[model samples]
Target: MISRSSQTAAIAFAVLILLLSASIGNAYEDVGVSISIKGTRSYKLKKEAQLLAKKQAIISYLKRVNPSAVGKSCAKQLVNDRAALIKRITTQEISQVGDYMEGSYLVRIDDEKLNYMLEELGCGAQNGATDVTILIMEEPPTKANISMILNPEDSTGVRKLRGLGPFAVFYTSYQRSIRDTIISKANKEGLKLTRLDTFDEFQKMRMSNDDPLVGVYFDDESEDFVINKRLLKVVRTRFAAQNTIVLYYRIESLYFDQVTRELNAAIAISLYDLNSGETKSVGSQDFMVIVPKGQSSVAIRDGLAEVASNAASLLMNQAKKQIRRMASIAQVHAQKKGTLPVTVTVHLKSKRTMYNVKKNLKPSMIRHSEIKGDSLILKLTKGIQADDFVYGELLGVLEGMGIKIPENNINLNGQEVIIQQ
Candidate 1:
């Protein structure tokens, strides 16, 4: 022990052990995996196949350095942080088979991240629940970019009703109904329903589409991440789990015939493969109603509201299968990439307020007329009943916005309510 040569030999042995440990800590292995998923022609199949390959590869990598973590209750944790794990994964030799869209892939996961994934799983810390937030798109879609991504049909005035406002009573009630059903269904699926804290901000930016049939879609890969990164940035800032899911929905279109008293409407929902910024799936359903020939307008209105609202919920049930599958893919891809219009009467301000009056006053007024300043011509079908309904609605809107007008200042007419400036 006292000799210099002996001391040097001991020191060398210690350094070698340190080097070996470091090497061990950084050990990784490439995995060859084959998978075939059943689906129509869609990138969704490819994405699913890749996730399977990566999962196999991750397990394979852990088998080499940390065999103890090979099997465990790691699923919950995986669902939550799969995005970061996905970022650490690499794929190659991807080949596709016919209509099945089957594929085999060579997959690899980063050593450090692999260890982290396993460690987190082993600790049982992550609840592994996916956070799901649901939002209804704002009508008229504040931004021009929305039309750029929406299908041509979605962009048509017949579908979008651009420059027109939807009836708040009709749409918001349907939205609330759908929202409640979505939550109840999601709860059954065991997903952790966390708030999509950034969604409101996202809507304000108008990067999303209001068309229920469209939802939010990005055709270009670059733009996908650009939009996703905004959400991810919020996730990071708020320390949200990486795999939060958002569902965007809206009433696609609705029509009513005054003479026949028949109603027809459709609603749609769209989901995306967030990492790639591509549409994963879109689901829509139509509902129709024939109001009883002699029913009061109030009864017809209430019945229509109930039918539209309940139809959207029923459609959610019909689309539940697709939604669940999309949510699953959403979970897998989530780890891969890393992560609002209220028309309130503003003191009954401009001629613009007439849009609200017509939409709220008489349903036909909204659909058939291009309302202009102080020039409303009441249809013979709309009478005292319509005026009472519209007047009450106008008062509610003003009060809702925290706006007040003394009766003395309110110059109310049969179809107009203008506040004195």
Candidate 2:
């Protein structure tokens, strides 16, 4: 019988090997495919078998790494490509039997160029992971947590924040856990995924001078925190809908059965459609699960991971129709937003102008933006006719942002608009 220590070591070794194998598969690594062909022993037959074997090897690699994108075009071009994918092709000892050729060939390849080509075709692991962002905000389960929400009597934000410590550290660690767990779950579900870090940028915009969200912080278990959360959800969902991204969000409130004192995690999901900027159903299923202790951040995270996993399941399965709709909208939005970019130059003299300029523009139109010295440079999205970019469109948005471009200072150079302060 195997000893417990020995079994533990063996299991650890097995896990290490599996991890190593997965890591290697992500990079340029040798992929081997075996082929068996029977025919008259001829050079043409040898060439044919080798080519098929190389294509098969590439297909095998794609199937292993990016199964979802392994379409007909993935290996279609390789059929006519002469050779060079072969690291080596070995033949069995029994190369020929009587008048017919019957043997096996093993093809091995580690072609970096082929890897680049596959990436271009979106048939490799490098381009496979879908970009995703998720937010999980937690609150303590107590009368205060319940009473502050929608309580018209408590007008000031002061009541909820009384004597409570800064939630930064807890929020950071918990967000990290939520991100890692959900992204891992997404990858296992064949939704290879990565997180798009945008919430901080959005928050920065919200706190800019003249912004309504100035001085508003989150996770305070307050009445307005729910409203503040909508901004977060909006940014995440809008970005998700605009880009090929997955955004999972949850507002977790720790609650108790008033009678039994049973701790539970209450999770709420957003049904807001970021693509069309509307509510899809004003509904996503809310979840409540009895979990371990939740008073401390550590305990809440450990318990929350399980409930978050269930929420992830709901997002990818039951709520997937929403995701699919967003994707379809994204495709149409992509086509509409095309590659024709018009430059909109803003004087970056004020921090307010810098943040709000990007914030106010139609997300679909803001392509590339940067601050060059004192100027906030924006290369707006291309696709729309340059003539269609009327000052009416530009001025209205600028007015919304409290930016006034004087006639003398505003110059239109074809598709480019230069506004100098």
Candidate 3:
């Protein structure tokens, strides 16, 4: 039995303990932090520095809160616990305010979120697993955009009909050889070539036609083929080349000299940077072949082959040079733009189909990916943008690899692309 005063004192003591316990539990509930990343001249490198600063901020905060729990080996240990760390360190918002000085970037980090992450990693609490956050640091590969232009008149005209086409056998043979050689050379160099057949196709489809070099015309017709440079400029503006290379080639002239009994061919070649609209003639070659007075099928075939071989050799050499130039351009562009983010969503029709999709995805292209039930979300390397062309290209690639992508099931909204089986 206690007195009234004693009972009141006992109740007060219990209340005091409850308050202390609550305060202890909520000690690190909300914290605030500001981190400044070192200056970098390159915008691409700036992102990398910022990511490092964020990681250091977390380590520093943990050390300040509980040195004993985090220990001296914390940084090394956190590396192994990245996945767990990312799950716990969540923020309502993260803002990049501005540059601190020179090229340094200033960022605001959520203190509360940082503290919570530390707690989860056994910084000041027990019964928790250690956590670590991972930041993607590597830049993605850049894609080269190449456009091939051919002179419309190159394939025109009537001459010694050796082949099935209306054109002279030599003319037809030379055209086929040049086209095939350029395409083959481009393919060997791992270039993605875009071939536009006609100026009308270029206009109607809204294809890129910036530099005048992109309009190559073989002067085969007796009438001169006039070009509208202004229309080309308009087309370029609407379809900005950005990081693209345009290639142009034309058969300047071709004729048969009956007195000399020789077939003469003149070709001109040029390369253009669509991004800058600058043009340079890589090289030009003039070929001549002696033909017999009486033309036999064998004689015609042999003459045509000789002309084609010489022309192809010259064309191929220029193509190789252009390929090297494109590689250099791609390297510089990648440094400037970093990597383009692409989100791909794959809708599954069946469990087997889901497995197939996962398996078929290129490992090199995938930066990060996750599957939510029947749908797979992938962050793939950027080469193809979210456009009708890309969608069609993707369909073709997948189909080629034995994946059936229904035509009506594909959708692309900006970078959020979806493909249903």
Candidate 4:
């Protein structure tokens, strides 16, 4: 009985020893030790690490590898075991590493990178982790104001501009706040802007001349556009001739006064410059004023104003003629230089019509005159030729009233005549 008891106790002791050994082995295998990286959590790893330091650290660790202890190779084992915990982040997100503890330093991954690594490790998950914050720049609104003013030579005439002048001219002023901004933006975008104001300035400069020139000008004040000087030069150029049409008139059946030795009646004279085609009053008094049909002093003023007015018309005609002469010379000179001058002519035959016989005929009945060099050649009022002379008297009366025939150009073939110029 004592031997059996001793055997049973020895067996129980062996079993207990085996069980304790198994428990100790399992405990050693189940140990949960953590490994960590000591560098930046928020900082970019590659940029922060110097190649030299990185290489040295890796070389040192390689040197410290204990060959006797491994199952997997050190490099392979580290990669496979800890790749889930190795966080990757962009350079901008990183700040710095945290406190060191025991023999390992805490790996301070960027909050963003930390979440990323946790997700990859199958430990924690997050949707967005790499977004960045930034500020936006904007531009201010533009502001501009424009104003106008008008200045007139004579207030009364200015008020009557709508009735007389072709048009009125006005000036303008501009105020812009965002001009610089617009310029800068234009430069950045590679664009060009025309300086409209420079043209306005140029027009103002041109208008400063005393002589009249044809051009467009601006003045903000009046807010009206105008033609500064009469455009007679162009008209004369188109007409090609300046005509000096002379009119001579004599007062008939006048009774003469003996006392004071003056005539009771007077004559007036005026001329129109055909080139300009305007009727300017020329007053020439060749008569006398008398008291109750007798000579008086009142006629002197009338004579003076009349004579001056007639002389003024003649002077204008003479000026136009001179201008035409110069233009003709220029044309000849240009032709010599191989530039051809254009000439236009027109001829029309007059036909008898019942309307022409009317006693009262308007000026519109006359056809437009031909431009001959610098003169306007108006057809003279004369007789007309009818297709059939059945109503010969009516035709003659009409011719006497409204027909304009060129006298110098008339040709005769036995009373059946042809007009020629």
State, as a TM-score between 0 and 1, how close model 4 is to the true structure: 0.17
Question: Candidate 1's residue-wise lDDT over 198-234, tens digit each?
Answer: 3443454333443122123332333221234444443
109-216, model 2: which lDDT tens digit per residue?
544445445546554332322322222222222224321121233335555453223222233433454455445544442343433333343445452232333112
lDDT of 2 at 47: 76
Q: Judging by TM-score, tell me the better candidate of 1 and 4.
A: 1
> Whole-model lDDT for model 1 versus the true structure?
0.43
Tens digits of lDDT, candidate 3, 163-236: 22312323334444555555554444333345443334245432122321233222334222324354454434
* Candidate RMSDs in order: 28.8, 13.4, 31.6, 49.2
> By the lDDT metric, which is better: model 2 or model 3?
2
Better of 2 and 3 by TM-score: 2
Candidate 4 lDDT: 0.27
lDDT score for residue 243 of model 1:
32
**TM-score of every model versus the real structure:** 0.34, 0.38, 0.35, 0.17
Most lDDT-accurate candidate = 2
For candidate 4, write residues 1-421 as lDDT tens digits.
4466555654553454344323321100011122233554423443333222322232222222211112224333433433342332212222334642112122322222222332343222111111111101111101011111112332245443322121122111001111222223222222222232233322443444321222223333553343333233332332232222212111111222334433222223232333334343333323223222221223322322332223222232222223223223332333352322221122222222322232223333323334343322333222332222212332354356555545543322221222222
Any runs in candidate 4 off by more than 4 Å, and if so which?
1-244, 248-255, 258-261, 286-341, 350-421
